[model samples]
Target chain A: MIPLDETDKNILNAIQFDFPLDVKPFEKLGEQLEIKEEELLRRIQRLNAAGAIRRIGPIINTKKLGGVSTLAAVSVPEANIDKVAEYINQYPEVSHNYLRPDKYNIWFTVSADDENRLNEILEDIEKETDCPLINLPTVRLFKIGVMFNIR
Target chain B: MKDIYIQLLRITQDGIPFTSRPFKDAAAELNISEEEVVDLIRKMQSEGIIRRFGASIGHRVLGITANAMCTWNVPDERVEEVGKIMAGFSEVTHCYERPRYPDWPYNLFTMVHSYTEEDCIRTAEDISKATGIEDYKLLFSEKEFKKTGIRI
Candidate 1:
């Protein structure tokens, strides 16, 4: 892990929330931090190259975009984890998938334009993996955003 | 959805290009003014279509190695109240009230991130203390199969 300094922390805190939607966002960001635009961009590039800044962009609301998502978990045997994970990752709709240390080891979040498509993708995944999957759609989304205040 | 907004989403979904004049570059591609791009984004924000517009930081790179998906077996009656409290914590990234199954009884799910497993446990304990819901299980991710932002 790269040790982050005060400036990097400040930059992460700033960009993790709202990035300026202006033409020269970096310039505005730098102005806020009392840094030069060129310096700010350079730091951001370094951060990106170092894998700190994954992407600087808009976080689209899937539901607002007429999409539906569900959290699905499947209990994969120890031997078939790799093969099953590969099969599950083949679907573009499976955005976040993880092998959790639980009975239902493989957990994933799948999103699609609608319920039908989402189910179709999940169905295909179940068929391919030959595993019974539990679909736990959000009953109520209390919070969906994550902004780690890296101070 | 307007054609222009669709085009804007398509262009911005991958991420806004890191450049001096990102909006201008996008505007030039879509044949729209920079102000138009900004205006559309602002509108989308107001409409709750854009949850956030910013840099998606890689937490693991920042030494936040531990991620625990904590599920609470809260009572159905108090699920909402507890969920609201859990959602207020900075460490609680994602919180939701999901339906319970016949075999699985966890109803409230939360994703907690920290630099260590102890930190994650502390966060979960804090949530438990705050909500007074102690029946919970934290499932740590052994391996990340895939992690990507959906381009919806």
Candidate 2:
């Protein structure tokens, strides 16, 4: 694990909670963290390089923005996991692909600009992988996305 | 105005540059004022188009190692109620009511993240106890091949 100082944690907390909207937003964040703006930016860059901070930006509600997404899962044999995953990853729309321990082992989510595009992608994935995949669409949104704070 | 916002979304969808003025860069790209860009962000946020403008930290880096996609066979009648209860837990990041297939006997899905697998299982059991939905399956992720937010 990358060692995170208190300032790093605070920066993560600040960015996640509410990134200030200002001409010099990092300056404002630095003031909040009692650090210099340069230091703040440097530390954030370091965190980014370390893969600690995934991205510092908006979580667009694509579904609300005329886009479609669905959860799809396939059961790949142990040896062919990487090959199948790589094949699925070739599609730019496929995101959050994880290998889970189940009959349906490789669980992935895909989002596209529209429903037709989404279906097309899923069909291609199923056809290419040669696996019986299930497309689990969201019936209801209990919690759309979680804003997880670093505790 | 709507067209311009679409361009803005395309520009900002990947992520704002970590530079001093993120909105300023997008504003420059869109040939609009920085104030206008920020205003559009606020407007989109208030309108619920922009879910939340924030950073997503690597959970594993912060000692949050375990991750479980816990699916429950919650009754159709109790999906909403049980979903709310499941979402109430701090560890449950995502909660949704999804349709179940003939083979797949789970409807309610919750993504649980914790420090360990044991913690995740315990939390799932706790959820089962609280919701009184005894049937559940915890699909712990063995490997994360790809995990990035939506890109337009």
Poorly placed runs, candidate 2 (over 4 Å): A30-39, A77-83, A124-130
DockQ of each: 0.77, 0.63
Clashes of each: 0, 0
Question: What is candidate 2's lDDT per residue for A19-62, written digit by digit as tens?
Answer: 88666788898898899988998998898888888777777788
Task: Give residue A113's error in model 1 in angstroms.
Answer: 2.8
How well is each residue in B1-152 modelled by candidate 2, as lDDT tens digits? 27876787788776677887778878888888998888888888898887887787777777888889999998888888999998888888899988888889899999988878999999999999999999889999889899876665
- How big is the positional error of residue A43 in model 1, measured in Å on the Cα after superposition? 1.4
Steric clash count of candidate 1:
0
Interface RMSD of 1: 1.5
* Tens-digit per-residue lDDT, A63-127, candidate 1: 87788999999988899999999998988888999999688999999888889999898888888
